[model samples]
Target chain A: MSNTLTPVLSGRADSPRLAWVLKRPELGVGGLAVVAMVVIGSINPAFWDAANLFSLLRANVITGILALGVMIVMLSGGIDVSFPAFAIAAMYLTIKGMIALGYDGVVLPFAVATMIGLLLGLINGLFVYGLRMIPLIVTLGTGTAVRGLLLGAVGSSQINIDRMPPALIGFGRLEFLRSVGGGNGLSTMVVLYAALAVMVHLMLRHTLIGRSIFALGGSEEAARRAGFNVRTTIFFIYGMAGALAGCTGLLHGSMIWVANPRDMVGIELDVIAAVVLGGTSIFGGRGSVMGTMLGVFTLVLLTNSLIIMHIDTTWQRIVTGSIVILAAAATSWRDRRIAA
Target chain B: MTATPARRMLALRPRRVDPALVQMAALAVVVFILMASLNPQRFLRPYVFDSITYMAPELGLLSIAMMLTMLSGGIDLSVIGLANLAGILAGLFFHATAGASGPDLRHAGAAVLCGGIGIAVTAGIVGGAINGLLITRARVTPILATIGSGQIFTGIALVLTGGPAIVGFPGAWSAIGNGRVLGVAAPLVIFIVIAGTIGGLLTRTPFGLSLKLIGTNTRAATFSGLRTGRTVLLSYILSGTLAATAGILLSARTNAAKSDYGISYLLQAVLIAVLGGTNPAGGRGSVWGVTLALFALMLLSSGLQLMRFSNFLVDFIWGAFLLLSIALNALRQRRR
Candidate 1:
């Protein structure tokens, strides 16, 4: 029996492919999210209502965008705790700068906001790569600094958009897909999120840089030995995260029509949780854009259901926290079981 | 010639003392300079001491709890949630037993002693056990597992109280939290004793050494026959207990227990642990370093408050300090 097991374990090609898919691991979380959505929708008719569905997707857009950036960082075997602060900072600065300069036109402000985001990302990248500092520490520091900058810039006042240039507000309200009944539709942001998700999926799965990311995450030393520039990979990953965060900031500004320094406070935890729940390993080296999308959806649905049920916001936080923990636990247990 | 060679060798050898202690010393010097420069006259006053003393108890206890888990190479993100829940539970128990009509001395005493200490400790241990079982046995990571448990516990607290605060505890309980005992607040006394006990245990006891071994090198520790799982589990239990104790103290001090009581302490506790030189990756740290770090943090916050900074500013400062300390520590390690 021992001899037979050894042969199978070391078998040349046939069995290894099966083992690879089993170990990819995120498939389980993705499956679970689908099951949860189906079960919940079956139980509550309102869950399937087109208006509610669109609204749910809309609510998750900001988190989804944030999670996309986080997924990139996580895949690079690093964590970024500063994305939320960066987002808030980007939003405040972009709004205030646009207002201060009287560039009320939509396109110019958008580009400037994105450029600010890219610069912020570049700073984070430099700190993590050039300085050889830990991502967690570097990002945490930047997160704080960014938040402080926002507070100092905006003071204590919330900057409201009174008559935003049609194009900017249009991004949030523009419907891309109208339902057959004509009572509900998908907004431009949701389409953007889906397209971005697809793009990230392709980048992670198909591109050479994407493979290098996986390699770096799997083992930095090995990746370096394989002729990959580990520092460059890390820098780009963090930059991608920052850029996505910037996009989310713009989305947030458009949706709320206000930029408050304190808005989306403590949202990093949610982003991390969503990424983890989506089946990305906290230690990195593994992730999936699709799984993360499902995770965002699951969380948004959970929060919406809680609201519909009239649960307090505090309890909702507790529940969301618990679900995140349980999801990570379940994934871990499954991984161990497969290993055995 | 032999003596001179030996002296050279001694001078070349690297220091083996705890980095955390050294960091704490550096932080203290920085604080001292700041205090002297900012407001020398008021800084030395008893009122400042009073403020520092008042802030120490719960935060100190929280830092110690965070230190234990971190030393074991794990994190307890749920400490804040547990503390909040425990505080709320203690408040509810105190109010129920003591009656809302007025301060019932006997009932209040029972609540503080039994309700606060007994129930809180038990709950904390159970919470820790749950986290341990999930992480060690079920293979869940520390952050996710504890976070999940934290959520459940917080939810339970909210459900128990219907999301409102539990207030109107007997004045005696508040007195115990607020009163001076031997020239220090009672919570401060408790904090000192607990810190001393924890410090002694980590340095002097076999269990402590086992924790260090596990934290430093899990595989090696396991190979050496240390019960790694059990040791990790015990650390979580200790963390949970301390968090719960902090919760009870907070409830006693405020004469109310709200769900938000411990929410703010999460970042602060982790910051104290890291700033005091506790490695985020785990293994090397000191109890004294954590205690001193707590004091430094408290002083910083108090000073910032006095300067009329917003809560957001204080939060940003804490986040910055945490990041800076860890990054500096990493740089130091790389040089070594």
Candidate 2:
């Protein structure tokens, strides 16, 4: 709207009252999520069951990780729809490599796949920073390229897994929250998600680099004048996103126990919806990892409840889409009102 | 003496250049040459022309819709979804009135077909109005608003038929989609007429001029007393209607309507529009440029299929090409 190629991701941090409200958007959204849960649980007692929560957490694993990655990108005043492609490509290549190379080892395969993902993200960073292109277009192009590569080359042979790397299977089955869910416990993947969330939360709150990211999102010129290396910060943001995507891909493949090529193709929308709905401003500098965490849970819970209610799955998209728009509109409107 | 004569000849000649036109012409040449070399047999045939003509209209129309929206500094992500919903609605009408699995649907007559077409177009227009309302009235960003509406439309479509294809149109409906007028597919003819009319609207009409002004600077336009909101709303309505028409054509030709019809078209439409040189930031584009882009892509894709290349391969090329061209476009802007 302002003639800036990147439509502002976050709101300005200068407004005292507005910034306070913006920074604390999660409280409102989180409350709504709780309300929805209570209402839905009353409607269907099964919705409150531990099994449902366990499965919901499992489903949230991929989206939760993706939200963390997207939060970083969005905070930096950019968007990355390319991460699903990154994850898919990374996982596909890893799966293919395992079969073709017969690598029984855990660390090597994942390391190679993640490096590839990082490389892909670096490409996005270069296009956005060096070429000075819009982040959406840069990532869109790269994302499509990665998807094309996956479909063109390794996509034809979807390998069914008879055996997984010892590490993956071990990671998948390990139970956390042993006291909950009727002995099924919380999944290892969900546990991993919590750990990652804490790590990201700390990074965003305490670290100088994290603070600079917010500054950059608020305004690049100001960030530059404040002595932040804008390009390096952006590059790192995209790279970090890519690395996270790769990790998620491995987890996905492990959970399914099959290297299905078509997996995670259109899931970017869900991830984005979750993050944005969680109260992350599309125009950056106002959001939190914890908020994103709540957003992911909100989405998962909504979808789960709909299924339990026997509502057509098609309605999920409608709801998700509406939530995204309403969240964004409310934020934008509030920001405008505050600015005025 | 020879050098003097050569220098004189070079200096005497006048130079003329139109960069946009030159770029478009060059793209056409490149696509033609690639196609001709790769699958000379089929591409060299007259039938291939018909095939290209047949496929071009639906895609071409969607691109025009996107281009128009982008020209106004907005986007309509809901077009494909809207189109499908419109088609599905039409299908429901025909199915209820005439019955499914009917014999020789062509004999269902022009009146019935006209009604079906009208419903689709009207639904499209209505959908567009909603999108416009959301943006202008609600203050939602174009992208997010359209996306939300798109989801709603898709949900409705699925609910209408429960995620199944709606079949059973009269045989005559296919004639409109597949038949020829002066050896040209009717859809192609419709496309040309639509393109010509819209082209005129953008360049010749006051509405078009005002829309452009609005896109270039909304605040300034508003200050000048232009009804910026109304203009945006009309642009979206036009887009929605066009997408609906495309949907009608698609369903008529395929003889079915489904929620997933042209599912891949959303991104492809945007790609083609951008490739046509519609400025994503808005306030710059040309109908001829978009038309040429449509032609080039049609050729490249059709040719690749003729050569037995996988669908994924073409997608790859398109993505890279869009990226490359955008990069080049930016570089050129920098140079200027």
Best by DockQ: 2
Q: What digit string (tens of lDDT, one per residue) describes model 2 on residues B1-336?
A: 223323432432324443665687799889899889877878888877778888889888998998899888888888988889988998888777677765635467678788888899999999999889888988877876787788778878988988889887777777768888997799999999999999999877767877777677677667667789999999999999999988988987888889878866766777778777777777777788889888888888888888888887777777787788778788878899
Per-model TM-score of chain B: 0.91, 0.92
Over B114-185, each residue of candidate 1 has an lDDT whose tens digit, in order, gives 655677778888888888888898778787687678777877888888878887766666766788887777
Residue-level error in angstroms, candidate 2, position B246:
1.4
Q: A1-340, model 1: which lDDT tens digit per residue?
A: 1211233345433366545654554555556556667877777767777778778888888899899989888888787878888887777787777667666666666666667777788788887777666576577667776787567546757876673444566666777568642666777788788898899899889998898888987888899999998877877788788888887887788877777767887677777778877778766677788878878777777767775665566577676777677667655654554456
Prediction 2 TM-score vs. true: 0.92
Worst 10-residue lDDT window, candidate 2 chain B: B5-14
Q: What is the C-alpha lDDT of each candidate?
A: 0.75, 0.80
User: Which runs of model 2 end up more than 4 angstroms from their true locations?
Assistant: A1-22, B1-18, B104-106
Checking candidate 1 for backbone clashes, the offending pairs are none
